[model samples]
Target: MTSVQQRTLYQWFEESALRQPDHPALEVGDEVLSFAGLRALAMTLAERIVHKHGRAPRRVALVASRTVAAYAGYLAAQRLGAGIVPLNPDHPDQRNLDIAQRAGVEVALVGGRSAGLFARLPERHRPTVLELDEDERADGPVPEGTPPAAYDLDGEAYLLFTSGSTGQPKGVPILHRHISPYLAHNITRYGITPGTRLSQVFGLTFDAHVFDLFATWGGGGTLVVPSATDLYSPVDFIVERRLTHWFSVPSVVREAQRLGNLPLGRAVTLRHSLFGAEPVTAQHVALWREVAPASQIHNVYGPTELAICCTNHRLTGPSARWPQYPGGTVPIGVMFPHMEGVLLGGDGLPADEGELCVRGPQRFDGYLDPRENAGRFLSYEDGGRAVAYDGSAPLTDRHWYRTGDRVRRVDGVMVHCGRLDQQVKVRGHRVEIGEVEAVLRRHPYVVDVAVAALPTDDGETELVAAYAGRAVDPAVFEAWLGDQVPLHMVPARIRRLDGLPLNDNGKTDRNALARILATREGS
Candidate 1:
């Protein structure tokens, strides 16, 4: 029997181990581990962690390369009731510190060959770092015995630092209660009852990984974690692993189709392909039809504040093309039944088309940054905290997370528009316009700057930065920026502006920037 307090995650791990001991749990190029072996490794690492952290659930900073040990550490952290704060391995050493400090990670879990890098970090950001000896893989003394575990769910599950509208990195705390329901919902929704084979292509930091992980294990499904190389090289990896289900970004599907790298000519045996993170454009749909036409392709939609997939749209037939979701609003199907949503206008009252406010079983408690949390969640009975009722007091205690998205409610269907906040969704990651502007302003030649996210094709959003500088070459500044920010965070297009256009309130006029871009495009 599984302990209810252990959360469904623990039970899933044990169940997968018992039923499919020899089934491969992770496949990274030449490396492979059976389900039983992976679970045992997770258990050994979790015990090692508890001993190092003094048997308490403390938020731990985990840094590792894109491989199996990284996967193991993530599950181990969860088993010990500790939230996982994943530091992107590619990020500059110093930049990682700023986020680590902000998230208040008490210890750093270093894995794989980079195990020694933790000690090199600056004191301020470097907590008491712990390096696991699992890389050795040598068997420990004594026969395998069931050891006591200290898994708790009430603690923070993960601390995700998202770019705030003001260039400040805001920390969101994902709690177990917030994630548990979605796990249960998707497990039943996708029918991952038992002996199911699942694939994991996304990076662990992404919220999609939660769905990929839980939906598989909670219902006794076998997980297959593919390496980054194997992710793009689909056939050798997919066919060899005999993958049955996968959750992938649209870009991967398109790239695979373009390269003819998939076994799409008929041998493809995908049961279902889940896609999300950004808009699923028509260009991406064509790729879906080409490669895995027989598989059920589902477009998932949900913000990180909510659990992985709050809503999904499954393509019913194989179509050569898809209608682009029109601008003003695009229906993301309906709520998960367990989840509910409402469209509210500026007055804090319900409206046919306005702000997208969500209430559901998957709603997160609040952000790690409490001040931001107050603004994100509210009781519909009470005035939404995001809007100052101008002067009206709040109504109730049921919490709701403000999606910060522009959505319209038409005939009971929620239509997603653009965002109301200065946020950008590039690829699948959220980039705060303010953060990019701040970094641009840091350039010695830069005097003023503004950044914008223009929606584009293939579910991909483009990032363009407009800045006024000291008459220096834009390429020089762009190259300098590459050293400071992650490659993904770098602006794709850079334009030198004489000065940023500002409105009366001392805010940059984004409309003017859009108009300028439009005028240029037209010319």
Candidate 2:
């Protein structure tokens, strides 16, 4: 029997392969790779890495998208006990190079489409490139005694880069122990089995992809990859792929509703549907239920610092029975059984509504840059006052990670409010942007909306809104909005767009909307 300390992320897939060698493990378009087949490919790639570097690298970069190289390369890195660093081909070359340099990536695995992108890397910071063709051919077997120790629970599994407030990317490294419990809990919670088929909608750059990969592989299930078009029409993909499980950002549901692509009760094969990385509205759930009538709907919430997700809410019974909260969004439910959470008020005291702080097995140790850890954690005193961690002492599990998002407890369930930073002052009145957006979404003509506070020439901030749906007269909409909320919440300028811009993670890009509003204000 494998001890808990001897478990690695790669061991999950290896176990599935031994149990069900012929089971279909991955489905990329028409190509389906069985568990045994994928294991062989990963072994071949791992051998290539060892042969090129004379040993397994400490970190490897994956510059591929939804290609076979991406999936196989991920497993290959795990097999060699190397930390995986996934790069986006769509990002600027300098940005990707900066990530590679920061992570100290020794080798890069490139797919056919990303070959040009990898070539753009300067030799000074560029890793040794292994161009994987579409055929996925292997050169030779790995020499004996080349592979490193396969199991190390404390070893770093992967390193991810997220946008920082300082105009740079912050590195977050997740260890195998930190993520093992997450995978174990979800695989059983979702009823994953060899017959289950899961959807892979998130890109490698997003942390949500961690669930799409390990959870499915660990349970001996199939991971079905979708194409670019499939994302816009997910209902069609769900029916065609015969997927039993589906997960993506809530924006996909809104886009499908806007495009009229969700047919009534068409996704009969799906058993579970999950939405996260953004707040989910009741309307999104209602529309999705119309299509996947028999599927269990869930809204999961978490930050990258807390693994994939720390809390989840399942919508059971009818729509009327579902818990409705302020901001017209679904409840975030409770924290996982293995974790503990507390809400801190503005005065650093315990409260029913405030910043959510958590501490548990799933919480990461700290950011890659020690400087980024300042003020990101909290230590509770005997009197229950939360003190901000100033890095005066060694960081320990006793400290709780401060998730910047605000939430309130309703009927013992946590409901997400807007982020603390999203609370902006307009004419000396603090207004929550999510509250404004929630009100705007009530209008029959509005499908999706994003409200931003932009700077004015007079050095004051004002509200501006960009909405996607039917074009309505701005004056009429503003008057209707003013009647519902205070006058300050109303936007000074309203713009109608065919659709709101989405970031790589499929969430509404508020920064891009702010830029657009600023540019239009100048124009």
Candidate 3:
């Protein structure tokens, strides 16, 4: 029923290369790499790596920006069966270096953009750096005794670090086994074909990038990457490239709508549109429908801990027909057939509203640090699932991962209620920041909004709202919002900007907003 039968990620690409060697695999601006071309380049780099190191290094780290070198380096490392640790060039140098050291990196594949940065690292801290050239070609025949492709589906594939609340980055190891089925399911579900053109909007650091890269390649489709300029004007980029599949964070939709760029009867080439990483509001979905009338829109949901997205709700028709969840966003829908999910209330028993617990074929085993597993999982035995998670209980593979996300089933569809930790005690009342943000986004002029419960130096927490749009009078907006919601729910401070700052993953930068608010308070 499906064309994708590869055991590993590299194998998927290799099969695509074999099936349609001349088919366009990657495109950025005028540059294009056919399946055969990309495979040849990656293999050539892998062969060179074997020659230099006598064998494949155990772990390879590379600056994971969206570039030809980054893509090639990833394939080369996979071809060598070496686990990859992608270093975010945009992240702080110390953080990247810390992750590199922590992951026990043996080699570094330096991209042209990050060569200088890697070059300046202290000698003791630096690994063996192999510079990758975008224009380099395979010079001669394969070197004698060139090592064979060694990737195993069960082995570690890549290491991704997510920002931790404790000021340290948490490392999550996504294995080939975890993602192989994920890629296959999406390729078939999304109806990807050789001629299908998908957008690559997420950076290498984010897990969504995994979907952008493999979903297209796995199904023998073309991957269209937009330049930084193109991202600011997504409608123009979508039209110019004639992208058939569009995927991005919901914020991009809001941004496009704010600029008045999403007019009706445009973006006709899009066949499947997917958005995740943040809540999708009704207004945003309506705007997207007008722009991409022919596309089937879906609001997918998952955490970085899970591979790509675990669940999605497809819009059957226009935005007005889209189901709205209690949190004021679209429903996230049911779990994929390959996974199982259970909701446990505060009492740790199955409830209509509770934290989501997931475990199945695609579920990740654990985090890099065993200690981080504390209280993050639920264990049960012999098919008897527990109603509540007991922190003192013993752990095993049978345990379900505590997603930390609260949700409820509305009309048999899962509706996200925001993160369990996102709930803040405001004046002894529990307030979900997501709830405030959702309501603010519904305002006529508010295109994008971010809410933060910033703590002042005096041990007081202030609810601050940062938004981007044409609503000039913050006082009027706040007063109107107060009339709509409870008094405590209204943001104490409103800061309006031309646009909300986005992090590398394209999510609204809450930390950046908190810092801006703190600075104004002279903290």
Candidate 4:
């Protein structure tokens, strides 16, 4: 096998196809595609893209999800040496169009129910749309005179848009060089082999989906995609598919428990169970263990900027022996051996508990918009004061990407305290919303809880909590919370909800929760 450093992202899949042409590469909705079959489909689609655009495009928009076109289009873009921009079909039409325009997409490969989405885009804003049906057929063997592999390791592989604090989506372009090492590490770490079957739980827009596709394809593993119904009942889906690996946000566990589908030892086939994109609570780990007793459970952590994930903590011993943290959340563990991590306190000095800053091979260069780079990176001077990158100079490898997530070292392991933005000032005393949410989660009737700091009519900031589970007396819950936390930390109002709303990435949507709470406050 070629060293990962010597190959581009496309080479990962190409090499696997050559090694296991007949192996099942993807299983989506009653259709199974072999490595050879999927590779040929990607070649055919690449040829069509070049013919339509008169040359290899600079960027391609994959406006689809959970369909053949979505996976094939991704490979097709890599073959053409074009950076991919994955637009979600479920996203608002205007939002998709905005991302396409910002990415300078030359062509769009539409699939499933998203054909209408592309049609709705104004012609001027729309890229050259190629409507690919869900049942698009693959071509025969590769032709004699196929275009040579056009991608370079240093070139951008995929561009993703994440919500920015400035109200507009920020484009994060990850180069092939940045992701190759990540794929190499995780494929070996997770023991992905030709027979390994992994569940595809994340959407194309989420950065984690990159691991679902490339890592599995890179290792010749089979990717089994779940449908909407399948996601609602993951235990049954895992059992039916015989999946060996599973990865999704921690919220899915709550959903499975809510539906009463999490039976003990049902998903016996799983070997690796990974949860990320949000904190993993002890309750979540306990319930998942009941379902997959033999599986090696890990709590992985990373932001989109760090390539899929940079840190992980595997629960090795019995459930009773696992280390417990203050918030009942699993530790994020140490940074990957290859990366460097430092916690910077409020005074810009290293501390035991503060914002985490990291730098390594897997870290991206900078945001596509240079302006967004301001204050996102940090540089140390004389090993003393931490200086934030002001976007005045070129972003170098020496700069550490400020994660904006506060973390604390507990008994030599790093525990996620929550986002720095999650801390708010209430009556001149700083409060971390996660601490309150963690306390509320202890309530027997609370399946999930989200704490948001909102302004009252009196111009004072107060914590507002929204909880989901069985109905509980607000007075009783408040009394219970009062006993668990400081008086200022107790929520000014507690609201009951059927379920906490989730964003596109499946993380609890604190912004949306704030709006919901604000509406009640105004009432």
Question: lDDT of each prediction vs. the true structure?
Answer: 0.68, 0.83, 0.77, 0.84
lDDT tens digits by residue: candidate 2, 1-523: 1222235789988899889999999999989988988887888888888888778888989988887767988999999999899987765566687788889899988877677665676767667888877778444443454475478888888899865555356788999998888888889889999999999998897888989999999989999999999988999999999999999987676667668777778998988999887677787888788889889999999888898899999986567777668988899999988888999999999889999999888899999888889899999855778899998787899999998889999998999986787666564334667777877888999999998988676435689999999998989998888766556668899889888889999999988989888786421
lDDT of 1 by residue, 4-31 (tens): 2236455556666677677666655567
Q: Which of candidates 1 and 4 reaches a greater TM-score? A: 1
Q: What is candidate 3's lDDT per residue for 1-523, written digit by digit as tens? A: 1233436778878888899999999997788988888887788888877777667888899885677767878888988888788876665565577788888888888777777765666788767788888666656544455588875988777888764544355688888888887888899999998999999998776788888988889899999999877877888889999899999887666656667666677799999899887667666677788888999989898776678788988885766766556856788888888777888877667788899988765677677876777777876444455633454555555778888888999999999876777656443233567777877887888888888997554333569888887765877887778655556668888887777778999998878877787665421
At residue 96, what lDDT does model 1 achieve?
72
Candidate 4, residues 1-523: lDDT per residue as tens digits?
A: 1344545778999999999999999999789999999999888888888777778888999987788867888898999899999987765566687788899998988886777766676788768878777777676777544578875988889999865544356789999988998888889999999999999998887888899998999989999999988988899999999999999977676767778877788898999999887667787888788889999999998877898789999986468887679887899998887778899999999999999999888899999899989999989644788999999999999899998899999999999986787655464333557667777888998898888887665335688889889988888888877665546678888989878889999999888988898886421
Q: Give the CA lDDT, 0 to 100, for residue 429 in model 3.
A: 33
Give stretches of model 2 more than 4 Å off: 1-6, 116-124, 137-149, 422-522
* Candidate 3 residue pairs in clash (backbone atoms < 3 Å): 348-387, 348-388, 349-387
Error of 1 at 419 (Å): 1.3
- Clash number for candidate 3: 3
Candidate 1 local distance difference test against the native: 0.68
